[model samples]
Target: MTTLRIILGDQLSTTISSLHDIDKHNDLILMCEVNEEAQYVKHHKKKIAFIFSAMRHFAEGLKKKKYNLLYTKLTDKENTGSFKGEVKKTIRQHHINHIIITHPGEHRVLEDIQSWETDLNVSLEIREDNRFICSTDEFTKWVKNRKQPRMEHFYRHMRKQKTVLMDDDKPIGGKWNYDTDNRKPPKSNLTIPKPCSQKPDQITKEVISLVNEKFKDHLGELDGFDLAITRDQALKALENFLSKRMPSFGDYQDAMLEGEPWMYHSHISTYLNAGLLLPMECVKAAEDAYLNGSAPMNAAEGFIRQILGWREYIRGIYWLKMPGYADMNFFNATRPLPSFYWTAKTDMNCLKQSISETKKNAYAHHIQRLMILGNFALLTGIDPKQVSEWFLIVYTDAYEWVELPNVYGMALFADGGYLASKPYAAGGSYINKMSNYCKNCEYNVKKKTGADACPFNYLYWNFLAKNKKKLEKNHRLAMMYSTYERMDEKTKKQIKNDSLQFLENLT
Candidate 1:
């Protein structure tokens, strides 16, 4: 009985679970570049190129191992556009009676895979993706009968379970989080370490050319496609980050610079999400940096929390609450996302820098994503689904499992309070504090109303005032409501009028 083993683009790791017990002679490994997956969201040109190139590189490695592999390039004449169609054709051609695949990362793909058994009339075995530290079953058990699934509580549990940053039974440095120390704003003269970039190999160059020709009208540019497409390059990137950038990573983890897109941030998310670098390896690298005194305890601890804590927590939350989670619109935010999000044609320097960087590189640090683009979307009341889709389309590192929780829950607060305790709504002042974009902005940061004032300043108050009944009861936002109530009627009226006028002219 021949078995067909399917591998998705994100499952590029040779150590992936589905490949564990493969029979080299009888089993055929199937990897395809399906249009259904690539064009599902009009993904960034760079993103498409990266995934395709990485998959091609990985397939070549499998070929060297003498495995029976059925690889379909996108431009191939007989290529089917969907995974199910391709699998059906492959099964019939190879006379296969059994199929095995790792569970897909996104809920949509998982739902589609669930129907494959009946459609193909074969014994389909969907194996668990064991790359993550916490399994879906484990996450579900942790959240069972819980009123609120707080990330910090989950993070603490993971710390104990994994012994990450642990000294015997307690956390090192006498603290679980170094977030307070990690929020220092960028200084104008700070020397930032640049992230390592890999020049494209022959395979990657061909993939880039293909993406340019096919996805010519896609969101981002492919001029400087320097991402690491192979496992060795990914390991080099991780080494560069730990040795050179980890020292200052925590100090300016939340800081942003106008033209500096990387700013001490590890650019390994693309590699990690693509399965080039395993999560445990990254966690251990940071811990090793701390133990060897190559990096500060705060820096190492903060970096570890992101991968071991926030990254894993978000994934667990995603798997635990999908299908219905994407439909959530807790605040009923219905305003359409503005054109500036696409065109980057705005006077707001922060938005311009962040969006432009995304369009050019398909990358932006977490702060730029959360505080700049996400904050604007939240304050302006853009539809959570629209914003979430925009995020999924534009970022190279975006996949629905990671992107949805971040946008729908943390960014827009669309899940009400499931992922985050408070809405991350903020004004221009917060941007000014964290970034240098305000120095070149057209609007005055000090002004709170009228033309020439930062739009965020007035819109922030407008959002609170408009959503008062819905948000005022939250203890986290009680202080802001009290402050708003103390404001004179004339000031409140000016804020409302200016905000409405600004929003009216947004398009």
Candidate 2:
């Protein structure tokens, strides 16, 4: 007469309300590690290690609280390599009549869970996932009667609703967003305080060894995998960020320095994404720092936007237009992902820094992913599927629900401007203005129409010119494309030739 409650690895919040009403005497918790998730995208070795280790820890914690737990290890002999198979076997063995689960993050997994209802006699009850600040129902309600869905408007609404960065029904500092102040370039000879690093203990090291042996050919290295695997450790990482890093996190969040990987970034995305830490707690910590005058308003506001604004917004977009969202390709791009992407051997200093850091740590800050590597892929028309696959495999915090909208819509503009207002397409000048990579590059950032010229120069203009018919109707891009049409034919041809040759070498 036991009811089984299934908890996915990402749903590890100790304070989950779904567990509140559970009768521990008659209910049991089931957590499993299936091969389908691990092999889906060749996940980073550290990412796999992080999840397995965290799940093991969570299961142990639940056991101490006198809760009946059925934990399935990945290397278990009975493992069927799929969630459906595992659930079916468990149901038969336990003779469970009712199955309760919190909502899954990905649309595919949600559908798979739904399929189980008719196949078994068990009543499947799904509780809403309340980890995010904005509920799916609330977001849908906000957009139920809207024509154009802009993130800015949505972000403002969130700010007011959450009472974050607001002052008595008005935005603080007379501005709702401090993003303009947050985009300053890195200062010369800046003394960046070294961030804290965690050393793997026995449990974490064992998980790392398993990942190395099992996922040997994955995208990232396992040597430097020092992420938090328990809630206590996650709190330490969060405290270290607010005290040592958050003060400068806003000023240089977008700035990329040579050979400096952690430049004022919190580096806590791995912990938050893995469910070891909750978003509300993280947001509260930032707010506390600001109220105490330990961190500036700009810094606190910027960090909150990343969490409550972009993070929540992307999740909403994924659920709103999914099931067929992964196949979007507005550009019809056919180019292979550049070979240099796999190896950090590019002449472009920006790409080199971004790629090399990602290879070592399996992470890069938001700007590095969006501006350098992502911008290059979008401008060159590399297949969005290929780019999205790379993103899914290479990051420590990559879950399809989060990675898809960010890469396919925001990065590649493959969804025809659904998640973004317009393409974040830009030439090398933007990179040069924002970073010091341009100073150390072999190609000339200023040159526009030759082999010696920076590829971004031609590719940026060519992307606009080639996709003009597709993008001309966008009001934000009208003036930009109008100028392209009036340009002399000879100039346009030379730019196109340069872009073509660079793309040829890129593949």
Candidate 3:
């Protein structure tokens, strides 16, 4: 029987499960650039271009190997505009009766794929996506009977299981985590190295043109389109990070600068998520750097933990709690995300800088996402759906499996204490301590209230006071509530009035 294998754009690796049992003679690979996927969220223009270019590049690589392949361009006359439509068309044209697919990253896509068997009357075999170190079933098994499924515990499990950063069966540097050594804020004299980048080859140039013509209204520009689009380029990017940046990656992993966006970061997450680089390969590379005495243990362990631990754990949480999880609003937040998110017109320097960088690069480091933008959303009470959509639309690396939990659970705490023990909400002082953004702002970070005060200050307290009934019981926040209770009645009233007035003025 002839088989039609469906490879989604994100599944660009040759090691993808669907391609493992290849029959060059009888199996035909079908890859489509559909409008439905691209237009799902007004995705960043660079993101669309990168994915399309990488898909085209991967298809070319397969063709060089003499595979039976059907590649669909977005402007193909016979293009069906949707994955299922394309699959049906391919089945009729090729007389294919069987379909093989790898499980998709998004739950919504999986539901549609699950329907294809009955809806199209075809034989469907969906294989497990083995690209990740931890399988969905493995994560489920790990969670069985566990009270709180946090990343820290799961990370340690992965470290030992994977034998990563292990010294005689023990974690290197005497601890499973080195976060205490890694939190030095960005200093004034810091010299940030830019990640390795390449000029767009002919294929990428064409893809950029296509994006310009088709998605001109998308969020980000094609200017400075320097991300790696192929596996070879992505490997170079990984090596470059280890040689030049990994040593300092942990120290400033959470730090932010006014104009500096790529401070000691690998910047390969886009490549990692797009399947150009395998997660294990990146993890091993960081581990090798530490053993070779190039990157310190704190840097290597921290970096490895992000890939092997947090990345896997987050994906686990996503699969474990999705479909119903997206609808959670633990804070019952209902405010519309203000227009300043799109325009970067806010007086707060941190928000303005984070949004402006997001508009330019379709990327922001974790702290900017968590403390600045996500923190503001949490503090000011933006609806989770709106915040989630904005994040999904903007980042080049944001697929729903990873992006959803990070934004919904880690960023907004919309899942409440289920995913995070405490809200990541913070005031201007935290930003002031961690970043130089507060230094250049119009509002004073030190001020507690008034017109010239940072909005985060009151918004932070307001979010706490407003959600006290739900959050005060949390052990992590006991001290915070005690501090709030210590304030005199007049001070509390002023805080209430300032918060109301500031939030009311938001548009």
Candidate 4:
């Protein structure tokens, strides 16, 4: 029987499970740059270019391995623009009798794959995606009978199971997390090492041209498009981070600096999410770094936790509660996202800095995403669906599985604290402490209520007050509510009025 193995854009790794049993000379390896995936949410132009270039490179690698491949470019006239349409076309052309596909990363895509057996009249084998440390079945089993699936507990389980950061059955240094040690504020004159970049190869240049012509009106410009497209380049990036950035990375992982977008960051999320870098590979390298004394324990452990712990847990929560999880809106926040999010025209300096960097580079570290842009969206009551799409559209590292839980649960608390224990709401004071954004702001960070006051200050309190009924019982938020309650009646009213005026004026 003729067999066709389909590889999705994110499944660019040769080690991907679907390719394991392939008959190199007979079975056709099919890869397509379909229109439907690219235009799903008007993804950033650079993201389109990045994925397309990487896909093309991966296809070339397959051909080099003597694998019979059917690669479909986007501009091909026979391209049908949808995965199903392309698959049907391929079946007709090749007269394939059977198909094999690794499970996709998104629910909608998975739902579409479910119909292939009935719709195409072919035997379909959907292989388990073994790239993830936690499979869907594994996560489902782990979540059983648990009221709240906490990431820390899950992290510890993964640590013990994988033997990562462990010393003879116990966690290394008697701790599974060094997150507390990783939160040092940005120190003055901190000279951060910049991340490594790769110049565009011919394949990438062609893809960039295609994205420029096809997705001109997309979120970001591809002017200086630079990212590792192949596995070797991705490994180089890992080495660069270990040697240059990893030492300071743990110290200021949470700290943000004005004009320094790549401060002590791995900048490897795009690579990791794309399958160019495997999770355990990155985790092991960091572990090796600490073992050899090239990097500190906190630095290595913090990096390992993000990939082995949080990244895996986020994927688990996504699969565990999806389809319905996307629709959840616990607070029923209905405010429209302001245009400034798109144009980065906001008067709030922190928002402007974060959004501007996002628009330029399709990136912002976790703090900027959580404490600044996301905090604003939550405080201003922007619709969760709208905010989620904005994040998906603007970030190169964002896939539905990873992005959804972060936005719905971690950022907006829209899933009723399913993924996070409490809402990640924060006022301007937090931003001022972590970043230099407040130094040049037009609005005073210290002011709580007025036109000249930082909007986050009043909006933070206003969010707590508005959601008092829903969040009052949350133990984590008790102190915030107590602080809000201690304010005099007049102060409360002024805060309400100021928040109303500020939100009303937002456009």
> Clash number for every model?
0, 0, 0, 0
Cα lDDT tens digits, model 1, 1-507, are 689999999999999999999999889999999999999999999999999999999999999999999999999999989998899899899998998999899999998888888977898999999899989898999999989888888888999899999988899989998889998999999887777988998999899899989989899888878999998999999999999999999999999998899999889999999999899999999999999999998899889888888899899989888889999998898889999899999999999999999999999999989988998888888899999999999998999999999999899899999899999999989999999899999999989987899999989999999999889999999999999999999999999999888878874
lDDT scores in order: 0.92, 0.87, 0.91, 0.91
> Which sections of candidate 1 miss by over 4 Å?
none
Q: Model 4, 379-478: lDDT tens per residue?
A: 9999999999999999999899999999999999999988889999999888988988899999999999988999899999999999999999999999
The C-alpha stretches of model 4 lying farther than 4 A from their native spots are none
TM-score of 3: 0.99
**Collision pairs in model 2:** none
* Candidate 1, residue 286: lDDT: 95
Model 3's lDDT to the true fold? 0.91
Q: Write the per-residue lDDT of candidate 2 for residues 1-507, one digit (tens) a residue.
A: 678898898888877655768898888888999889888878878788889988888888999998989988888999998888888888999888888898898887999999999987678988888788888999898878777777878888998998887787898778878888898989878888776677888878888888888889987777767787888988998999999999999999889888888899998887887777888788888988998899998899899888988888888888888868899999998799987888989898899989999988888888899999899999998998899889988888888889999999899999898778899998998898878898889999999778778888889999998998899899999888888889899989999998888877777
Error of 2 at 382 (Å): 1.3
TM-score of 1: 0.99
lDDT of 2 at 249: 92
How many angstroms is residue 443 displaced in model 2 relative to the true structure, after the best TM-score fit? 1.0
